[model samples]
Target: MKTRLGCLSNKSDSCSDFSEFLPPAQETAARSLKLSTDEAEQWSESFDVLLSHKYGLSAFRAFLKTEFSDENIEFWTACEEYKKIKSSAKLVSKANKIYKEFIDVQAPREVNIDYRTREKTRRCLEDPSPTSLNEVQAKIYSLMEKDSYPRFLRSKMYQDIINRTHAKCQRRSV
Candidate 1:
């Protein structure tokens, strides 16, 4: 079964497939949202700092895909979205869906979390709230921030964005 990661599509089963399968239009748009020098500086400051911008999050998500840990970010994003559901009915269903998809052991895109965190999240189903997944989400966020975020700063993919954006800025000034 194919796992959906928002608009990104690929024939490969997992995000680790390294093949460049992004649609041309998306690739172009991603490139155009290039990281300016100041943006790069801010991104380097901290993970939360970087994620504040949509472009930064997109670039980081792409980097996570290469590492086969895109599910972590994907789950984190889902939880963030889940928090915004004002309808009690929608909240319950969406919370359950997120748990089954990213927290269940048999889930195709299961995220990495301790048994304790998983159990806590499972318990949240009894009485769903906007903060149902807060604990687990924080764990994933910390994982990305401590482990992946630093590596992403040094990644060629990131450097390329910085370079491209710098060049674009230079061209504009000429």
Candidate 2:
């Protein structure tokens, strides 16, 4: 099935070659949050750890390029669309369209990877009922509050694992 992140959920199909971008275990829990305002703020707080420090923004951009396939094409398209759109609020929308319509479709091989990433990201925020919320939240928050880039990158696989755990918890709660 197609996942929100535009990747296939099946584990067999790996995404791109940028496996080095995997986040650390401690921070993976927190870094996998949905691409929302809170997540952005959280990322911003750890800008050093996320962007300028190591493979932060560069890694993210690389992953995005792999996920999207054609880097500049879509970004430029989004930029153009963003300019055309009368509403300032549509910037994200324009960008998303650039991602979903152009980028996602351009690369079929990476769809599964995108889906996996999406599914994993969703799982990070969930918990089984109210009981595990504290634990899950704490797990992620702690990682975000502390930790270095190298330490986090070493345990990148945990990002997907943590996502699946959250998904399980959420399903149990539902």
Candidate 3:
């Protein structure tokens, strides 16, 4: 089945190279990432914890990319950034941009929202507010929490990080 981000084959070969899932900058940054064992386990505590942690969020985003569902996080993050805009003009412009990119019917990065939520988000573009995208963003957040977050916790990528972190801790204590 096609996911929220884009379609990819089910074969593990499709994403065999983890670097293919991240941009060049992120690949470099992630390569240098050194996550502690304690912090790695803490990410599994909740989706919010994972997102609030720099390395945890990066790893989750990479996992989502491999699953072709990164758009959900991108859109959710964009909505978060959108809410913090203090300028009226900038807020309206960003609202329209976000709508065009994620909420429009044929948006390149359209999220898997129902028609009602999509239309409601669209209507807010006319007179944008800090909370303009709150409803749709909430729906996306719930979807990720219920669906992607669990799979991410169980993903090989996440497991690898935990194992590697544990090994590193062991070496330090040795």
lDDT of each: 0.74, 0.37, 0.77
Off by over 4 Å in 2: 1-48, 52-55, 59-86, 89-152, 155-174
lDDT of 2 by residue, 1-174 (tens): 032223213462232212333334533444443332223223345534354423234344443444343343234323344555555345445544433543354533222224544444235323212221233223333433343333334444325433444454565589
**RMSD in angstroms between candidate 2 and the native structure over all alpha carbons:** 19.1
Query: How close to the true structure is residue 24 of candidate 1, measured as C-alpha lDDT?
Result: 49
lDDT of 3 by residue, 1-174 (tens): 133112123333222123334556675555544558888899989999998987666667877877889899999989989989999999999998999898899899989999988887788778999998999999999999999999999887677666666766787799
State which candidate has the highest TM-score. Answer: 3
- Residue 17's lDDT within candidate 3 is 24
| Model 1 lDDT per residue over 140-161, tens place | 9998888999999998766665
lDDT for model 2 comes to 0.37
Find the 10 residues in a row with the least total lDDT in model 2.
Answer: 127-136
Model 2 misses residue 13 by how many Å? Answer: 35
| Window of ten residues with lowest summed lDDT in model 3 | 1-10
